[model samples]
Target: MKISRTIHMTNSGRKHKTNKIKSIYNNMLAEFKRGEIGYSTIAILGQSCLGSIAVILLLMNDMPTMIKMVQLFLVTVFCMAFNGAVLAQLKSKITFDLLIATILLSACVIVTNLV
Candidate 1:
């Protein structure tokens, strides 16, 4: 709760971290209220999954659309990966959101590559 230790700064630093956590919690609650599963989570996981599917389709017959889909998926994967890395340094809801997205992306890439 309080995080009583002054590891970084004094009240100012602790206050910032506490605020960051609060913001994250609020964002999570807002997502729940809107009946949304956190946009970041959806984007990361969805794009990756789509990419994997596209790759599979490409391997099956190499359709033209598959190429476009793979390109789109790759873009999304890269964007989400960058966001995840940034969030890894932040103390906010985005961190969890990004982490989930990273996992989804990794899973999709691995599965699709195998396929």
Candidate 2:
């Protein structure tokens, strides 16, 4: 009696078996690093809208000037960080949208709080 052993004989068969898995993911990296896409424009737009509302509320409450000033500083810093994250992703460089967003948010917060 004789026995025969068969092996996979075609390149196409071997290639077909590996077609199930698509991408390779590295598990050692952290999420949202530099040059990372932090959030979409819609999300940032929403955040800005919320900030505007907060400023309006502060104005209605007649908050202290000192508090307003501090809030302004914090708002500026936060805006810079937020815009930097987006620009870093889009332009692949450490840029900031501070020119507009930061100033506008700070002014809004401070002006609203003062009133």
Candidate 3:
């Protein structure tokens, strides 16, 4: 039936989109590993600044104490992980991945605080 055909087409389209995103992500990771996209110093500083800002925002927010503590713990863990990556001199890809994750997590926290 036309409805079944449409559903199948939609599923196919979703798969295609997902594959495209994955391909793009992989390409970016490759480029980062090759030292073509990010700098270690900048990423380190960014992680530090963003982490501090996230902590400040979390503390200033009117959220419940338990929720605040949980978010703070996550932020601290992420920051520490990034620091550990630098201290351990891990590969560029791993360090960059952690930096990106830290930035994203901090951005989420900041946005949540503002909104």
Locate the minimum summed-lDDT window of 10 residues in model 3: 1-10
Summing lDDT over every window of 10 consecutive residues in candidate 2, give the lowest-scoring window. 23-32
Candidate 1 vs. true structure, TM-score: 0.30
For model 3, the superposed segments whose C-alpha errors exceed 4 Å read 1-18, 36-38
**TM values, all candidates:** 0.30, 0.41, 0.72
* Candidate No. with top TM-score: 3
Q: For model 2, how does the per-residue alpha-carbon lDDT over 41-85 read when each residue is reduced to its tens digit?
A: 643575566566655666466557888667756774666576556
In model 2, what lDDT does residue 101 have? 57
What order do candidates take by lDDT, descending? Answer: 3, 1, 2
lDDT of each: 0.56, 0.52, 0.83
Q: Which of the two candidates, 1 or 3, achieves a greater lDDT against the reference?
A: 3
RMSD of each: 13.2, 12.2, 7.9
Show pairs that collide, candidate 1: none
Candidate 2: give the clashing pairs: none
Per-residue lDDT over 17-62 for candidate 3, one digit per residue giving the tens place of the 0 to 100 score = 4587778878877777776334666677778999999999899989
